[model samples]
Target: MNPSASQNIRPETVAKVRTGIPGFDSISEGGLPRARATLIAGTAGSAKTVFAVHYLAAGITQADEPGVFVTFEDSVADVRKNMLGFGWDIARWEKEGKWAFVDAAPDAEGPIAIVGDYDLGGLLARIEHAVKKIGAKRVSLDSLNALFVQFKDHAMLRAELFRITSTLKRMGVTVVFTGERIDEYGDVTRHGIEEFVADNVVILRNSLEEERRRRTVEILKMRGTTHQRGEFPFTLSSREGIIVIPLSQIQLTQSSSTVRITSGVKELDRMCGGGFFRDSVILASGASGTGKTLLVTQFMSGGFKAKERSLLFAFEESKDQLFRNAAAWGMDFAGMEQKERLMVVNRYPHAMAMEDHLVEMQQIIDDFKPNRVAVDSLSALERVSSLRGFREFVISLTSTLKQKETAGLFTSTSPSLLGGTSVTEKHISTLTDSIILLRYVESFGTMRRALVVLKMRGSQHDDAIREYTIDGKGMHIGDRLSAITGVLSGHTTFEGE
Candidate 1:
């Protein structure tokens, strides 16, 4: 493939209903078919309603396609209020006769609303009334589950599902029908009748795994179209609405070739291959007082010198305190801030949610377009909240860095609670693109720190754990200390002469 073609956005050649959600249409390989029905199934809290509302709103705003929202669960006013996150004034559209809402809650009750009593005819008439009144081209049924009360039998509901979906398709109105799906156990809230009815099935799932709740989406099937089939992570915010940071788009790009960070100490950069690679993630882990701070600060300073913007989110120290400490080491801190190349974000553990911190960091990244980002000490992040929340925060933070092609350097305090190579927080290690272990070893009644490059994706790094130090002149690295052992265990032994 040509290198430049990787970032290209070739517009799709199809009559489609564009769901204006960011990173959404691109993943669908374009957009939903113009006059077809797409099923959105997921357990509650999977954002099935939010997804349905956003699709309708996006069509009204982006495609200029008038829309009708048929609600079986909530009232029209309730649905509109729920969608306030999209920054949409739905009432204005309704007033303009370009959109309409129909409540099916009453029809979904004791009386059978299947064929003639309160059936497809009445529903179709209401939809047509709304469409012709305002020239609407898109529709969203809040749920297909409500029909179960009206159509008691599986075979009967299945027929009604087909009838409703087919009627909308034949009317040339793009439709999104919301439903629910069973989990990995196939134990759904109900049968899969609704899933089998729609032409395209997209499942959204959110679950608690290992103390963390994550959201993922997959396309079960999309008839007559080739769609990428995988459950990718996504976030829905009040500001950006719904966004899925496609990992598929994160291939190493040539544009990131020239970015670099300064080793906190000059000699340290020479020990490692050239400074850290652009857009790469580097993990700096060590026990207390191993010069990890000096190394990371040097990297931050390097970014400042190059006039590349950077963010320093420190949990271990205040901005003034870090500056004072750096000054003691003879590192230039005041000079860099004068040049406007660096910005520090200091926060305490109890202030907010890990998710909130990620959101705030994302805003700063988007505003500054920084090339370097540093989160000093992953251990500090752990101190704030639940393990799962921290993992989600890390995932969101790292994923944002890769998307923006920013070189991220994170420090972690290790030598674990049990004092061995085993890490209680394995999620941090798994998410990092590279791992640099720092250990303080006791040798002959003296304390010394060692540095080792454990892992680096897409780039080779030296594997030796060399002796390193920090004094008034800043950090320094010496040749590999072959005489020492037990460095990883936090205890050291040397060969006797």
Candidate 2:
């Protein structure tokens, strides 16, 4: 390898323009290609129009760049009204000259008659005028499939769209053309428009599995640029439009912090080698009546006692139930919340898809700026999600918690009363920094409870499976059960007489 030759070598890459939709840029490896036509294809009701509107909206609000939106399916008035829900004031942008709409949607005459020897000259002329009128740097021809309905010549339609795309690129305008996906996993373009014009292709899918709606976005191709490949889960938000969750693309470069925080129980803290790491994710797994929720309550109380704000997402219990449970444990959850030291959000396990729940949880975690976050029994969420969705949720939640450096304690419920692993634990056990297992032990016709620090990364922890009791004052940790074995396996055996 010659030094001079190595110095002259450069990576081949495409310059990108940020799309402004959240989470899209990270997977796109920056943004969409600049001065190129990218096809946004999706089925009906998959938020294709919203994605286009949000892209141009992002340019105007984020970069002060003007845009032209050519609607071929929905009317301009309808678009202005529909986008208001996402809080995009398209009307205001139009008045400010930051946006121009080429109303190409078919009226009673069917989309301007393909004007002048069937060449798309009239519509193309309108688009060119709108671009020059606003000095636009971005253009979106939404739902180009509608134009196919008006004009039956598939070969000619592709040629005309390509010509329009070429003209836009020559003007240095970054472009997005939305098309309809005939099937969720079908070909990229139904009319083969992308084959001629698109320098990049993006596909959006709203798939239904087990009666649950799961939305995803994939960068099928980026001609001159590199991008993370795969179908990343995404969801539509009322505030920000489409948000893609790049689960596999999230970098595993979180910094490890030596600082420890209490697990809210003193003996438990000592057992975990001082306490849980500040940026660590801890999983507490046990069966019903095993004090899993009690542990979550204590964890939050401990943070509140330390003058640190703690946030708890309760999927298995209501706010009132949690408050009552905390009160029974000699803790004041309501009082802590009153002082703003704690924020408890309770939601049903089946409320939304895994991605939607992830977005909401991240927003709350960021807004609260909590020092600790706890999810009461992730098994509740797991029961309602598919195996893949559950795993994605757990990984995403763990990554976000680590990135924010917020201590997270997630609880999981075991299926068996004695000894068994839950599906939730199997998916997230490796991602967590520590694992605390609570199990039931049968001793001479009596049922007893035990707790153990099963695994702790980066520090020494007590391996003893010690007996624990729950009374009015909360869990009391005791000496290790030395004479008994197999405490974790739930089938206890006496070692010596």
Candidate 3:
């Protein structure tokens, strides 16, 4: 209870062990406290096992430090098979004396039975033996809730876990203990016994929001250390294990350039003070059929014509549709691909979670090293996630694009065909460096299209709502709608009506 006692328990200069989990070490400051036990608690199907396996696998593969995995819930074979998807070859690791398993599952070989106020001396001894045999610097005891379930006395279970953790720490082995939670938002653990033994506590949550499931990890507390607060979104990848998206930890030190890149449309470029910034995110928002895609096509072509690499992620159209549409607009998407000047990736919005989509797309951006990137119709992805999730996705995406120091153009479809604000605009307006609005205007008895440079950060832009026309060639920016008012609100009035 005293500050001096707390300081004595965990010294001010406590060292940390990098967990090797992607993006986790950033949020955890420098990773888990060395030679201390960390509690990973989560509800059913929260990938708790995967997290534990990943922690050890990272140490084994990246640091070449051996690890001991002690399982209490899942069998050793299941753990091995389930982890192969993440490219962790547990069997091979075991053969090379790099990994050891202390299988303590019920009815398994050397199961520890709980009769009355049972001591974990036998299990601890087995764990110590495994650690000694493999020379494991990292150890994981998965799902301690299994032991808690059998032990009715909570106080006794807590005492035993503390003792076990203490013994492991004394061995100078950094440890991880996975526990179970009944509810995603309930106590840290099912039995709430690990709070005393764990030097750090991390919670994994898979919560359902608006018919979509979102997974996030939060480091509740880390003794004698600072960590990023709040839950950070993470996704399970087949190649990599659990990847924590350290959104807050991303540095916004992207270098700004005075140079500008073409917006593909000469008039639009002139309107935008000689084109968009070299490292900026632009949003093209409009109702469907407002030529947002056409604008995007022109933007890409402008870059490709200059021999700059371009990447496009089409969410609302297929490869054929996009290529065909480009052909219709007199753009050669297929030829660009063949020439290796442009890369077009078409993905259905419902294919994966927003987090996965962001991570995968970011990876492609990094790999392709494009000079500019575009996402056609982000509104299509909006229906698949909650507003908050979509906002996070946009923030992360814009930050990534900026960090890449490449120009990014994103399209969003408004729900109203005539005129209206979109959900996407509400969430991503401030995040984007520029906003281009396309609207349909009804003058007299005919429908015409209009364009507006709504907001352009760090540059002077045309504030006039200009009427535009689209034909087989492409969008042609015409004169400003001098006689129209309130074009953005979808309700246009004659100047002197």
Which tens-of-lDDT digit does each residue in 332-354 have in candidate 2? 99899999999999998888888
Root-mean-square deviation of Cα positions for candidate 2 versus the true structure, in angstroms: 3.2
Best candidate per lDDT, number? 2
After superposition, candidate 3 runs with Cα above 4 Å error: 1-12, 108-118, 150-156, 251-255
Rank ordering of all candidates by lDDT, starting from the highest = 2, 3, 1
lDDT of each: 0.72, 0.89, 0.88
Candidate 1 per-residue C-alpha lDDT over 307-411 given as tens digits, one digit per residue, 9 for 90 to 100: 788778888888898888778887667777776677777888556555556666788888878889888867786776577567666776777887788988888
List all candidate RMSDs to the true structure. 5.1, 3.2, 4.0
So what's the TM-score on candidate 2?
A: 0.96
Which of candidates 2 and 3 is the stronger one according to TM-score? 2
TM-score of 3: 0.93
Per-candidate TM-score against the hidden true structure: 0.79, 0.96, 0.93
Query: What lDDT score goes with residue 30 in model 2?
Result: 74
Worst 10 residues of 2 by lDDT: 1-10
For model 2 the local lDDT of residue 67 reads: 95
